[model samples]
Target chain A: MTSWLPTLQTATPEDGYDLAVKLARVAVKATQPDAAVRDRLRPEYAEDADALIAVSHVVATHFATVAAANNYWRNRT
Target chain B: MTSWLPTLQTATPEDGYDLAVKLARVAVKATQPDAAVRDRLRPEYAEDADALIAVSHVVATHFATVAAANNYWRNRT
Candidate 1:
């Protein structure tokens, strides 16, 4: 979308879900912040860091679960 | 992926992300629980229902953020 946020790669749904998790993690990296993105998300983020932090975990777990499911199926074949 | 879980439609990354949110909510539907999934996710979910409920919101919001971006580009064209 906008050039500000880190982009999630999307080769396929399965792969994209996995990538979104990674992108979110990168966005929250302690060492570096995308200035434009920080400005863009500032309002809600300043108000609710807890909620934003919580999702970084949830979406990561959700994608992992989906990835694990794919692995489970691939092994069956 | 499995028949037991709600399937996400995957055409592209942008669209798939949106669909993932819908699938998650469907999986958590109050009326019908996916028996197989409930069993699979029992350990974590049984321990904490709050986080799972919260991701249902995050992923949805994340998808909407992306969709708005796509529209932002489309409108400019």
Candidate 2:
């Protein structure tokens, strides 16, 4: 599938970067047990569900990857 | 301090982004407990240890945010 985060035509690199961060923030709010915060982040994905979901998956995997890498080196040197 | 990944002067948006993914991959390889792969990723962190470390932290936190956000809404709606 096409890249949802990087390929948006009208989005500047800065915009895309900011959006990535926004999506990242929303992702964290997603795992919370609270309904209100979840409600707040809903609009981001509501109109473009598929793209948002795809972005979410990429963002999640990316996070897991980097976190593990940083921790690995942290212990070694 | 300045942003690590985004602020790299020579980096294109695509390059900065690809580097982000590379960092993530390196992060995962880091947790493998395998010496060889860890050796491989060390060069990435070697010269600009401060910037690479900064990028790692941001990537980690961003990933955490998005993953949690995705999961929260996944269960609810």
Top candidate, metric TM-score: 1
How well is each residue in A8-35 modelled by candidate 1, as lDDT tens digits? 3333444545454555455465445777
Per-residue lDDT for A1-77 in model 2, tens only? 44433321222334434454554543233233356644544564455666456555555555453333233234433
Runs off by more than 4 Å, candidate 1: A1-9, A32-53, A56-77, B1-7, B10-53, B62-77
For residue A24, model 1's alpha carbon misses the true position, in angstroms, by 1.4
Interface RMSD of 2: 15.8
**A58 in model 2: Cα distance from truth in Å?**
6.1
Stretches of candidate 2 above 4 Å error? A1-77, B1-9, B35-77
Cα interface RMSD of each candidate = 11.2, 15.8
lDDT of 2 by residue, B1-77 (tens): 67544432221223334344455555566578797876776555433323333343455454444333333122321
**Model 1 lDDT, residue B27, Cα:** 27
